[model samples]
Target chain A: MSSASPFHGLSAFPATPANIDGRVDTEALGRLLERLCEAGVASIGLLGSTGIYAYLTREERLRAVKAAVECVAGRIPLIVGAGALRTDHAVGLARDAEAAGADALLLAPVSYTPLTQEEAYEHFLAVAKATKLPVCIYNNPGTTHFTFSRELLQRLSDIETIRAVKMPLPVDGDLPGELAALREKTDLAIGYSGDWGAADALLSGADAWYSVVGGLLPRTTLGLAKAAMAGDVDGARRLDKLFAPLWQTFKAFGSIRVVYMLLEHLSLARAELPRPLLPLKSADRQRVLEIVEPLIALEGGRKS
Target chain B: MSSASPFHGLSAFPATPANIDGRVDTEALGRLLERLCEAGVASIGLLGSTGIYAYLTREERLRAVKAAVECVAGRIPLIVGAGALRTDHAVGLARDAEAAGADALLLAPVSYTPLTQEEAYEHFLAVAKATKLPVCIYNNPGTTHFTFSRELLQRLSDIETIRAVKMPLPVDGDLPGELAALREKTDLAIGYSGDWGAADALLSGADAWYSVVGGLLPRTTLGLAKAAMAGDVDGARRLDKLFAPLWQTFKAFGSIRVVYMLLEHLSLARAELPRPLLPLKSADRQRVLEIVEPLIALEGGRKS
Candidate 1:
């Protein structure tokens, strides 16, 4: 059943950055992809919320997707972010990404306003119609503010091209029962985001994962995913303990900004972010590097 | 102090609907525009969240703005919605709206992702820079799940074209306080959306009012605004009471659908929304008519 799914395993949402002039640093992104692919990442998620896409122009985003697709060169599955607040634009990007050779799309639910479940269902349907590739629905109420409900999920599954979901634990409502209910839904793999919850969601039957903190410290998460898959509960528990302290950093203002800062701290991406997203302060940056340096080293040492 | 500011006043988010066949019903919309103009609406908000903009294509939205501009015919200020999720797309729409002779723009912050203040600010600056018109910033967190903090608002106001703010009262948050702080900091007119908090915001020193519910009961809302402006607290309170039951209708799901239904019921405009936002059900249809008929009669009797 899993063999047929477009995304079968761990996916890294590669943090994208710009040069001093604010243009996407394609070369740096290429190096990061090379490292990620060499380290055996199954899929690469560029142009995500972590990728600072909201700041880039449509043309810049299109160029970035093409660049990533060229660099990844089919070494691993590449998922592009093609969602906008409007259906036409979202569908347009979906079609563009397909033509650009993305293996799949990490589509966000409708934004800018609270969407009715029916509208959300239709949004998914429109994107699915736009492209032939697999579509991974992103459900992050912590940011998008609209939760693609289970009813939306069930309805979306009926559409043949929707292949997976990115369920970051909604900060507001209860999703424990929601995740439990997801187990009986379909063959579609559910991926966890926000590393603190990854191990738990895996235990709750999630199949794949989207990691921001994982990029900053990969092996700790990779180990946890491996342990969970192998049913090694103790190993998973230890990794979870290691990740628990680092998770607190994401709870502040501009979580995505923080995610990019963490990535930059590890020399994985550029230090700059697009306008409106303030860069981390020198003191805060130094502190983050100090706190997470050991774990990043752990990931570095584990790399083959 | 206020005279020096380029933006400071009331505004109405005009609903744009087609006929049953999806063609822009200009005659109907013209009448609605005339009615709003007659009501002394400070600026006309075209293609906003209430306008069912997400359902319209780029071509359709541009045409809608063009049509609204022609209909209004310089009778009042035309503030178009340039709030697309992507930077270039939104800037493109902003340019088109400006070219169409729109008086101002109402831009929602970055969509889909809870953009960093810098990203949201940049999105605003890019749109503001795209056109020379005064820009009214729209901060509705209920739909976007992202609030532009007062600090962020200050940053946004730095752009010369960013002249105002249209903040809808957020769901489950202190809107009155938020609006008050924003009002104190900038010379921008702070209009209350959803109208539930309009009276309070006015009492708290808000300069203007905006609402979908008020569009449904313009007489009552206008009466309240007039009364509040005249310091007629008792009279203002009276109109607020009258619109309460009617306000309950727009508070639910398909409120945008219901707005079109009422506009049709009153013969104000056509009863069509763009695709993806379907018409209401048969049973709900009956309930809506039954619920608002008396208020319409009561308001109509007052007019005659």
Candidate 2:
């Protein structure tokens, strides 16, 4: 897979369910993945940032990804996240992900920076070289705290198998200008990210949205994607209006936990998240339900 | 181990050495631990924040603690860091660390927070219930991006196993005056973190110092500790002067990467840090060396 090898469209990073003892709720996670895949998820990006991969050990992560890959059975792209804070470990993850039948690797650069571009390039090159599978650069400086400069992205694009970028829009900066400039400079396939920033990113020309929101509301994502794909900008606006309130109400609890709550509300899985990260608070949960209730009800109404 | 356990004096978070391929530089690491023990390190804290525990997988972290425990041969108290964004995993690490011969644990309550005191208290309580070993509640908001407020600390103090606190000087607020008042309400073991705030904390009635600086420049830390312990403020001040300029250099590359670099400079074994984090640059190395030149040379002037 090269830069143009089309893994870009809509992707969802489904949450990994775990028992209270911290054992992977493998059965529940598999069900969640199957639901998304059955609902026509374009790609199942296992162990992505939103998957809480950082909190899970490498072995657990490998196990989850392998299970997802086996369950999905190559129906959609299985893009395993291969971003570790260290080069050797990231390479190790990439190598294992490849062995486990991951279709592509979404690699984030060394997050703790003031990383020299050379060091960042070397990290990607090492991970890219370690695996024969395609690698997409996931540049979400907002979380990873590091961004790949267009020049660095272009340098990475030089590798034959390097493909795609999942760029999260920086909160304080303008995304459209940056994406336009970045798109102009590199042949790297670009996708947008952040639930709150998705519509703006779509309007600005990113080929897909890294839909964390999609994992919670697959049909909403599909409806929005259809509207955006057909250049039906007004219809896209309507979907955004319906779904965007979620980004605000749940913003208090954080994207992951809020999404996890939404999943619980949707009856997809148990509400238990790993501790250090608790499930939504009762007061917050009540507020979240107030917001999530209507959007879910709207979906119910649409389906009817 | 209950929260009421008495803790006193210094505890050292020893570093793990690694080979070039990022495998355990076990021989080097073993030697370093033995050297630290021989130097009268009161407690051996492995895989704590200072030990880059976050950068290691569960297996790797377990292996490291086991290696350190074996090398030290029970010569010192063996405390392991068992904190992650996931609480259950933190408990698992605690149980494993104890099984591997750790005397205690240092727990950091982190990962996606807005966590109420009730949730944090429950988190600690759950970990306390899971492991047999006494746990040191790590309070470093600087890294975790969440502070354990005094009221929360007071609530945590009620727990039987939260015997100690690794107080990182607050990032914004003044060093724990009200918290110190709150501290008076409980008999918790109080230790000053060695993260550049040691001098002030020692003055503020904190017991002992767990210094990464000690891991690098033992001469400086030993001298500083001795002076501070003796109430010889001027003697501690002299050593503090030598350590001051070297402080911000590592902040440029992050504390862990800098720790590895300092290990390299000390001619102790060091290797690549784990992913999302990158290795230090040549310029960073050069600058780090330049900043610590006087301090590195201080060993030569030591009467020992």
lDDT on C-alpha atoms for all candidate structures: 0.70, 0.72
What TM-score, over all chains together, does every model reach?
Answer: 0.80, 0.85
Enumerate residue pairs that collide in model 1.
A114-B143, A275-B118, A275-B119, A276-B117, A276-B118, A276-B119, A277-B118, A277-B119
Residue A223, candidate 1: Cα error in Å is 3.3
Q: For model 1, state the Cα shift of residue A28 in Å.
A: 3.8
**lDDT digits (tens) for residues B185-264 of candidate 2:** 76677887745777766656677677776666665567777777677788878877778877776555666777777776
Which has the greatest TM-score?
A: 2
Q: Kindly report the fnat of each predicted structure, to 2 decimals.
A: 0.45, 0.49
TM-score of each model's chain B: 0.88, 0.88
> Chain A TM-score of each model, in the order shown?
0.89, 0.91
